[model samples]
Target: MRKSSIYSVLFGTVIFTTITAALVSVSSNVAIAQILPISDRNKSENSISQVNVLFVNPSIGNDTKANGSESAPLKTITQALRVAKANTEIRLAKGTYSAEMGEEFPLIIKQGVSIQGDPGSQGKDIIIQGGGEYLSRYYGSKNIAIVGTGNAKLAGLTITNPTPRGYGLWIESDRPVVENNTFTGSTQDGVAVMGNAAPQIRNNNFYGNGANGITISGTSQAQIEQNTFQNTGFGINIAQNASPQIIANKISGNRTGIVVQASSSPVLRNNSIFSNKEDGLVVIAKAIPDLGNSSSPGGNQFSSNGRYDINAASATQQVSAYGNNLASNRIAGKVDLTATAAPVKPLSLLTRRTPTLLNSRLQRETVTPQPTVPNTDSQELNYVQIQPGTIEFTAPGAASQSSSLPALQPASTGNSALLPVPPDQIPASKTGSPYMLPPGLSQNPATIQPTPQTPPQITATTTQTGSRYRVIVEAVTPKQQELVKFIVSDAFQTNRAGKQVMQAGIFSDRNKAKNLVRQFKNNGLKAEVIME
Candidate 1:
């Protein structure tokens, strides 16, 4: 058995282990993932998220006051993430998000939340930088920019980690979607998949990272399809029981194209592995990649390298390359180049995976001076919510109502009152009364008249700070709504004796939250808010 000690990479603790020391055992390498315990894999979260969308505009956001609306956008990704719920879409604008911008590093992407930018242009102007201390499961206290988990989606952004041996994206969740982004300037690897993450990585550009553009290890079953890997130490490195499906990727112009080691088993098909400064493909340390077999033909193409096109000379190995296009003289090891093998079945190509920028199940928005909320839900539950500001949605035609929920005031002693709304939902007004005004306004909705409903109370689980409030916003089935009885929050309180809710907006300066609640009560949608 391999001997190993505790090391950290911001997953758990902070004993910094160098790259050279990680090489002592393959399990200690930066590419090795902290294997999660059984309890972590089966963690349970039952509450459906109330937030449909969150907009982040670093140029003009309010980490303290903004409600994560397109008009009243949040100031930082960290704040948006803090309040984000499952299935929430965190939309980012074209700007640099760095430590200078108050963004914490290793932005842990929660389950069902999507962090997106301009995917059409391949995130040309979207740049996220800097590193923060993360407690690794094994490697303690490593710097990472982003950590993705819980079926999250990362798309249309440019991510970079410049710290020595830092990773750009560390994936440790199951079945997340990573697409249409650029990974550049990371010191170690651009994107590393560890644990049992079965991520779909596609349509991305991996350029100019210090080590491999992408690293797959720790039993991750990733689907790497249609990505461009260039200008790296090694374009793709597979190690330690990682059996990824490498299909239709362009791997070229690197120190070495692909390196498989330490018992990795990746299946390659239709890959253009060619033209590297060193060997095109190096298989060592008992790694036996499935190029192809006699029954099935591998459509992989290999070409010119400074050394041999395929190098497996040092280790004892016999790999099959049935019908894969390569020159026999350029190979240095025992490779089966039986090109004329009969096919058992037709080759199944890997298809590209794309996530709906805006799913119909979520809120839809249209472009204008302000965001236009959709009318997707039935009249009973038809409430306006935040929509994508920068990205357009293909969801059916939506209306122009923006949801501005007024929250309850928090009480001390970690306990407060609840203002519960009735079951199902209350139909919304066609006019979308009290639509949130554009940012920088002295008084939003310039036209909302005040009412006399007492503001709802928020119960506290912790001490409240920096203008935090929890407003009941949506209406769910009574069975689900019963959770409010047992659950109390600093920003959220449950006290409404099982009734319907109202939407609200500004009333005056003395009590904006209450005033907004009163005004929104006119629209019939209860709201909630929390301050961290």
Candidate 2:
């Protein structure tokens, strides 16, 4: 062994180690570039616990130090929210959690985290009540927004009682899925999505809300399907440059069944729009929707609307109306554009005849009072003499041949049969028999005649049946037109029997038709009929 040999070996080892380190460094740089750390992960991981916090029932009064567990649970949703770390899931139990009015439990989900409700568990129910008044004060301040530059998810819970400006559920995280929840009584929109977020919202029920049932805005892309909106002001509203896919929903009884506005390009398909107060589907100012062709065999069928079944304001917007059975709508004329342009004709003569009969029957029942007569009469006489108001006269002195007559003039001042005639008053042939007048004047004597009043003039207007009782079903969204037609058909069959005529068709002026529907409803019939 020589000193030179030992030194050479050590040098070779050092060189080899340097080359290996360089190679490792290059590999690490490439990996860093390809997989950047999620924004929240940039923090020190050692500072947080690996275990997720589970809050069954969080109360402000309970010990905040207690770990999230069945026996030792966090007090309030706010407390659990505070302790939740990135990628941690906070499972809540089912129970009513009360919050003070205007006091919001703000949550900033860092990255890849979820706040979920325990299935079938009590005490995890999250109720955001009066505290949401602050939400109203700060418009556009989202109740919950996942902005951690990562994906998130919320599921299986009930969100309700938000203030006028507060949103029930809001998401800004990328590729989040919000499903299997109930949103009720929201003062504003039931659910809102904003930013560049793309999410899936499905299988939810929104009812009795002040504003839109679901809203997608701010350049967000969402898949909203299999949801229901009942008694809401608007079923689904898309605005603010958002592009969403709405499919297979049941929307009814809203002011506008479905509204597409603010330059949104939503894919609406296979939705049921019926019985809404206004248009079944509405594409308002600046909305540019691309409705695909009908997939049904016969294209699309549009029929049986209480009002116009389809309406579109923008002529540039393309709507395909095929594969529908149009029938039983309450419109004056045809439902398509070709028929609307022709000269309007007067109502059919047979239809016009109906109102005359109706008016005549009503008039006869109101006019012509029954006749009445006096029960007694008074007369002046030397001796007190009574003259019956009603006298019974015999044809030949037989009871069966007698008839009663009302005394128009008082009986002669005295009983002429009992009075003695003076010699001067007696006629020449009255000596042996009763006095008689000349044959011509004796048989029939005329009494004083009264002038006749002109018969009351009876003027009746020529009756005609106008468009008063007709209805027009309308669909605001092209996606709902087919379903609208089917529902209208069903309604027509149910409503039209004897007097009510049902006819279904399309219309350009859906708003005017909706106004008429309200009028029809006021006349004891269901109006505002929409088919989606």
Candidate 3:
């Protein structure tokens, strides 16, 4: 019995040893398989000599038979996009590439594809222009120049001439790396981000855009860094509950440096915001942009703005609690907070309190700032006050019937309203009352006189500082109008209540207004021509 027991134990030990050795061998193989370094993987994937690499040259390449090689390159980017597979590298040579040749627009850059331009020569070599009328309008059907799907890369390229709502690059639901790109003459946002897209946008230039340089909304978290915005409507407009990292940007020569609206909470740091037509940063709605971190507040340089440095006064229109961290910014103007719903705690409570310009080269000293006071400008929401001078209002097509909007004319001064009007100035609706003007002015149509005066010394309203309203056609509840006023501001001139479900614009031609109404309806927005 003892011998049998010893034999059983020996058998069990042998079995256990054999099992352990086999398991160890399998584990070693698995570990080896998982041991690829990130850098090595990237190098292998992004290798230019890869089989899927394609080339595009507008001047020399032909689209019909080219296999995307250097010797026989493709003509248009559209053609390359169609044939290129995942991980494909589309290299563009020195030339102007347009989508007019092939009607494919809103050029979709597929996942894992990289579109590169000659970077050593500074992107002047490659120009990608979206030149169709339908593609240029920001809100047009085909307005976007490029749409990055995800995991795509665009480097060292110049994109220009996209119309309204048309974006130079519209990234949706993707993590794309867009670097060293120049965007100019975009009718709307140069770059528009939506969904959970967290794109790395770096070292780009945006100039002369009709709308915001970068507009990130709908939960996007873009890392926008080291970019320059000049002559754009707004440097960046963050809205719709999005949070993005805006760092080390030179936002200058724009209408507004940055507008944080809706429920956005952007991370702003180490940026130079100066020389904007409006405020350096305009925080409206419930936006709470994090301007600093724990150690020493995010220090940004703000100067030469037309209005206050940080205007959080948007709540004055409709009272709502808004909070923002303005702790460590080197502001040239006041942090206007008089219109906020609740009294804000001083920035000293949240910061370590260093006053040095950490990023600015010009100044390095710790300076104690002056006491911040609220904007003492008058709160007139309805009208912008101008100095005692003439106001001009020319009808779109009828120059002879040109006159100033009398309703906008100040009621205080009769001399405040002076515009040249011909004998046929009055519309047919007011033919009986020929002297009928907007609300407060009275003149005889029979003897309408002209007065030539110097140009008006225009002054902005408290809410609308140095900005004019444009006519909009849309339908919204009175409360929702506030949201539309900031988001689609070009749609309406004033925040006045409309009579019907929709409010239309000022158009001289009935056919144009009808066409616009049809276009709006086509886009699922109710619109009609309601001539005043």
Worst 10 residues of 3 by lDDT: 379-388
Which of the predicted structures, 2 or 3, would earn the higher TM-score when compared with the native? 3
Q: What TM-score does each of the candidates earn?
A: 0.55, 0.47, 0.55
lDDT-wise, the better of 2 and 3 is 3
lDDT of 1: 0.56
Model 2, TM vs. native: 0.47
lDDT of each residue in 131-172, candidate 3, tens digit only = 332332222243567888779999988776444234578776
Ranking by TM-score: 1, 3, 2
lDDT of 2 by residue, 192-277 (tens): 66666777777776765434577666566777777777755457766545667666777776545665553555655566677665
Model 2 Cα shift for residue 43 (angstroms): 25
Where in model 1 is the C-alpha error above 4 Å? Answer: 1-50, 339-532
* Two-way lDDT contest, 1 vs 3, winner: 1
